[model samples]
Target chain A: MNFDLVAQLAISGLVIGSLYALLGVSFGLVYQTSKIFHLAGAIPFAAAGYAAVWAAKSLQLSIWLSIFIGLAAAVIIGVLILVLGYFPLIKKKATLLSLFLISLGLSVAFPNLLQIVFGVDNLPLEVYDAEGNPAVPFANPTYASGFLTITKLNIVQVVSSWLLVIAVLYTIKKTALGRSITALRTNPAMASAVGINNKVVYLVVFSVSSFLMGVAGILITLQFVANPTMGLQWTLIGFIAVFFGGITSLGGSALGGLILGLLSSLSGIWLGSQYAPIVTFAILFLTLLIRPQGLFGKEAI
Target chain B: MKTTNLILNASNINGGYGKHQVLRDVNINVGAGEIVGICGHNGAGKTTLLKSIFGIQPLTSGEVVFKDKDVTGFNTSKVTALGMSFTPSDRPLFRDLTIVENLQLGAHIVKDRSLIADRIAEVMEIFPILAERRNLLAGRLSGGQQRQLSLGMALMVQPSVMLLDEPSLGISPAVVEKTFEIIKDLAARKGMSVLLVEQNVRAMVKITDRVYVLRNGEIVLEESGDDSRKRTDWWQLF
Candidate 1:
């Protein structure tokens, strides 16, 4: 492994890792607050990605407006899940395992539904020049020292992910709503006695998590092409990152995302692309077997 | 005799987890400024009765009237909003949160932030140990302190009716004495109505104004606190 090749791998890993971190954080957020593993969370990401492109092209909207529209769509989907899925289950006092299976079923149902509506064809957004040819612009000039090239998108992803993480951490640590969430997690009965509405809190958590996941999906779409079938893969990667970080620990998930990204990149470099998924799954299986609680997860009662 | 205002009334309530039916048509009441002690053997439906009143458990048949309103089947949050607070037998505290945070959560229904803060401060004064350990995580507290914290949390809502289940279940004798003292003080000083459920009949009788001894999911005996205390056969109820 040459220095240039290692640097390239490192840079790409960090970019992909930040995306994973965003997805993983969304997963952790809903899981910690509501104890619901929303497998359908991934649909928001794929939906948002496809919606962003459709908004820009069909609706003739700007990039930023399209992103906002995508986010709003995600929020609406999330609220629907809470109203239609979570509320009924909780009201019925359904077991956690039952809720988990329901979420899994929803995950499968949502993307296929998307496929029916959007078609199974993969759509890549095109950037065209005056000549109607594919145009790739270097937004920020990269300083190439040997073989390592740094791009503006990489910087945006890394810097934005860090800023978002910091903001979320601050909110959780300093805000009254955050305190209520913590209270709910620790003792829900006591939280209610204290006057916190569990349903409202769960709604807030699910919406926020979904919004972040939507943003992550948009980012991934920008990097790759949007496909109806991409949700499952994104969900799998997010779950792995979440478990790697420790299911309950947000900070742990962020670190886990970065580590998984680095591992994937290194595997792709050394062992070839075909070995990447195997390595990721191998790590996930071993982690579950050795530390079912994840690296920082609390023991479940 | 003056008719005492009834704050909470549970009439012929039957409730349980699944079909077990721990509470079999139990009738209980708490009057304004009254401390009612409910003593029963394990699985005798004391906790179930309290839980049904607090909306933690659903009643199969019967009605729970609070302050002249039928509140049976209301969710726990709605019940709390109607000025009732419950501390369960297990003393469920937000273990990861600081004592102050835990107390703040107790007053979550209070929309006016400043009023909530004032209530929290007032509660801290009553449980000074909680104030002293305000920054400590609830999990680190002693069993007695945890119980006090749980009680304090219930009180933070400034509930007109407070439900406490086994406040001294796992605490030391000294802590139990202190707990009973606090219960007595809250009743006398604040005129708070309490439904105290306990397995320790003797200690419970000392602070309670009235006692209901339950056995096999039914009220087997009912006596004034003074009469219950003087009776030599009180141990037979347990």
Candidate 2:
């Protein structure tokens, strides 16, 4: 592979990896606390991207404002799931499998509902100039001592993704909320007995996770066109990242995302791009077979 | 004795886990400044009775009164808000939290931050070891220290009645003795009412003012500590 191509691919990989990490963190948070596999979490990512695009186009809102609206919508969706979808089952002490199925049903329903509203066409977010015209940057080539360089968007994605990962890590490590989350993960019954309202904690966690997922959706949309079906691919990548990292460890998930990103990128370059998914799935299957707990998972009680 | 009124009353209580009736029509009462010991075999309803009072386990059919107010069917937090605290036998301390954080959680119902701090200070005065290890993670503490922390957490709420389930379980003999001593001090000095459930009949009788022997979800024997000790034939129930 050429040096220019390698740099470009690596940067793209990092951006995708960062988005994956954010998604993994969201999935990990819910799984760690409630031990419920929230299949509906994927919906927020697709919904937010589409919502942002539609709002920006139809309402003539600023892109940033549209993003915020999308995030708010994601939070509402999260609360709906927590209250309407999960609460009743939880109140009844429903089995984990049943909760998983319910989440799956919501996951399927959310995207299909979006398709019905927005149609199945891929929606491109309009990046405009002062003249209200598409401002597609011309491809600038660099040939310096037998090497080429890519555009600035790749650089921005690389920097922003890493920054977000660091910020998330710092927040979870240093905050009171983080401590409470850790305590709940370790022993929820004890945490509740000590007066930490489990319900409140779960709600906060769900909202935060959904917000992060929504943010990831925006970032991913910036990188590629948004579609009603994009959430499933992102969700699959997120699940792999979460499992690779050790489902319970936030740090592990971030690391897993980076590793998976690098692997997928390298495989796409070396092998056929079609083999990338196969390679990723093979790695995941092997990880599961060899170490079912993932890289940083705690030993089973 | 201060002659304080009864703090907890349970009449005709029946409960069990999953169709197995562990506590059957059991009647028990604990007054302020009283330490009531509940002793029973492994399968007996001692822990079940405590669970029923704490609202952790649903009562099959019974009435639980706290401070002469009917608190039956109240959830755990509501029951806790009503001046009753439970320390489960499993030592349900928030293992990932520091000792101070765990204590803070105990006073979670207290909305005023100042009052919560004051309660923490008061609990520290009672358990100096906890105060010393305030910054350490609860799981890092020795079993004895955890037991003390659990008891301290229960005390943080300043509950009228403290329900302690097997405070001595899994602790060293030395720590077990110290735990019982603290139980005694709470009853004697603080005038705290305690319902202590334990399988260790000998240790429980040493600190409790009154003793109840539970068998097959029923209280078959009730006596003063001295009377129960002198008549040791109850040991056969186990």
Highest TM-score: which candidate?
1
Residues B31-143, candidate 1: write the lDDT tens digits.
Answer: 99898999878888888788888887788999999999999989888888898988887756788989988877777777788888898888889889988989999999999
Give the 10-residue window scoring lowest on summed lDDT in candidate 2 chain A: A135-144
**TM-score of every candidate relative to the true structure:** 0.92, 0.87
Can you write out model 1's per-residue Cα lDDT over A64-134, one digit (the tens) per residue?
Answer: 77788888888888788889987898888899998999888988888788889888888664344445554
Q: Alpha carbon lDDT of residue B219, candidate 2?
A: 87
Can you write out model 2's per-residue Cα lDDT over B174-210, one digit (the tens) per residue?
Answer: 8788789988988677778889998777778888888
In model 1 chain A, the worst 10-residue window by lDDT is: A130-139
Model 1 residue pairs with clashes: none
Q: Which stretches of candidate 1 lie over 4 Å from their true place?
A: A125-146, A298-301, B1-3, B18-20, B235-238
Candidate 2 per-residue lDDT, tens place, A1-301, comes to: 5766776667657767777777878888888888889888988788788878877777767767777888887788887889899999988889999999999998878778878898888887654556677432221232233354545555555566667667767876776677667767877666656556678889998998888778787777765778877877787788898898788688888788878888787766678778878888987998888887778766421
> In DockQ, how does model 1 score against the reference complex?
0.60
Quality of candidate 1's docking, in CAPRI categories?
medium
